[model samples]
Target: MNSSVEKCHMFHESAVDLLTSIDFCESTLKTSIFFVAFNPIFWNIISRLEYYTHFLTKLTRNPRTGCYVLAVTIFSLGLVRNYFFEQALYKQGVTGVLQNEVAKVLGVALIIIGQVLVLTSMYQLGIIGTYCGDYFGILMKERVSAFPFNICENPMYRGSTLSFLGISLLQGKSAGLLITFFVHMVYEIALKFEEPFTMKIYRNPKKD
Candidate 1:
């Protein structure tokens, strides 16, 4: 009974917040509805946790799969998060997020560069490469030796971080900045766990 009451209270509080931020929430709600209504069967087919985990394991067991999962989730959700945040900020009349025209320009430049770096990394890695195949014990045939790979070991992760920070700076939204910080935290955590595993995977390519 008490647990039920607590859940009710939380719902009530969230409703109140929604009421206060009606316009922003409405836009957010609409976007969510659209995505759900169009639920891409293709993504659902591939993005299942079970299949991804298996796929991640094949390439290397050193923890690359988990890190890949984290990266893909962050990149995909970051796009949604930033979109909602921008709408909220606009509705709230929060302007100072962009210090000035010059700042906005610089922010846009950063966003573009960051996006290119991120996409390049993703392309080089491919879907499973970006996500992970360890659950299936399926590893990439070989290491990626491409432009971005040569330029930086983890270009995608670094670019993604830059993209979020850039968007936050461009919009001058403190909320966006906070979310970006959270993202960075997740990535950092993944890095701590994944890097050593990756090194091991590279060092000892054959498990059997």
Candidate 2:
């Protein structure tokens, strides 16, 4: 009986140790995810504000400079977003939180559809299409009623939002969903601020 008690105590200690290690791992993963997620969101808000202020004005000026600035802004955003995305995946992998075969297929499908919506908008609208046109002051053509534009009122913005969600699901990262939510919020704000101003710009011009 004494021997059995000793063995049971030993097993208990071993189980506690294993659980402790798992807890440590979970803490590290959460911390890592938080750090990676922060930077892109910071830059996105900053750049989006700056970009909107300059977009329309810049558009009316030399398109070369306008394009350059747009490219810089978008590229910067892409890099940061990618890093966050990578970190989300890393955390999920560590936690074994990813979806299995069925989810994998669904995630892939959403990703493709979302990308199509986004890229279609870009292709139909060009650089100005995917970005806030207010910075350069370059109004898009009178109409953008084509491709992805037809599918969603703000295809570029919605597509981007979808892309984030799709990628997150594909990566099996629950944190990715939160990040995507933030992206959508930001884009929605930008859309509300930007779309009317642009419509007015083009609309007034025709009236003149």
Candidate 3:
């Protein structure tokens, strides 16, 4: 009877440790998501402001250059966000059946598909169209209805979120799933502003 009680105590302690680790990981994941969400919203607002103020345009002396600057800034922030996401995953404790080979394979497949969608979309859009060049009077001739875009309205955002999920699965991290959901939410909110503003730019076809 004493041996059984000791075993139960050990099991309870282990479970408590696991729960504590999960809580820590979740808090870190939330911070990473916050930065990831903030990046797009920050750039979108800044780009729109630049469109009206021309501060970036005057500094760069070319609208395209300013757009490129913004793109680079966004890209750098993205790298940082990803780094934090990976760190959060590393901090998380693996649980359940997600650590199996089948899950790993599925995660790899999802990553591959996500990469294909992202790369193809970028190739079709080019740097100008891929970034917020429309804000600088650089507009695409028409909307691109390619393979990925044909399937979904925002393939890039969708693909990115998928990639995040894939990475989470590969790591068997539940925190990753939460972060992925936040990523999707942030992209959806961004689109609410981005899509309409882009359409207005095309409709007007004049730079301020």
Best by TM-score: 3
RMSD of 1: 12.0
Give one digit per residue, the lDDT tens place, for model 1 in 18-109: 33433434465345334322322223334344343444344446455544664566457655655665664454433342457886787788
* Alpha-carbon shift of residue 193 in model 3 (angstroms): 1.2
Evaluation by lDDT, superior candidate among 1 and 3:
3
Stretches > 4 Å off in candidate 2: 1-61, 93-98, 204-208
- In order, candidate lDDTs are 0.59, 0.60, 0.82
Error of 2 at 94 (Å): 6.3
Model 2, span 71-188: residue lDDT tens: 6776675776567556555654321334466656777888888888877777887765455443344556568686766666877667767777787667656556656776777666
- Top model by lDDT, which number? 3
TM-scores for all candidates: the values are: 0.56, 0.64, 0.85
Total clashes for model 2: 15
For all the candidates, what are their Cα RMSDs to the real structure? 12.0, 9.3, 6.0
Name the lDDT of candidate 3.
Answer: 0.82
Clash counts per candidate, in order, are: 20, 15, 0
RMSD of 2: 9.3
Higher TM-score: candidate 1 or 2?
2
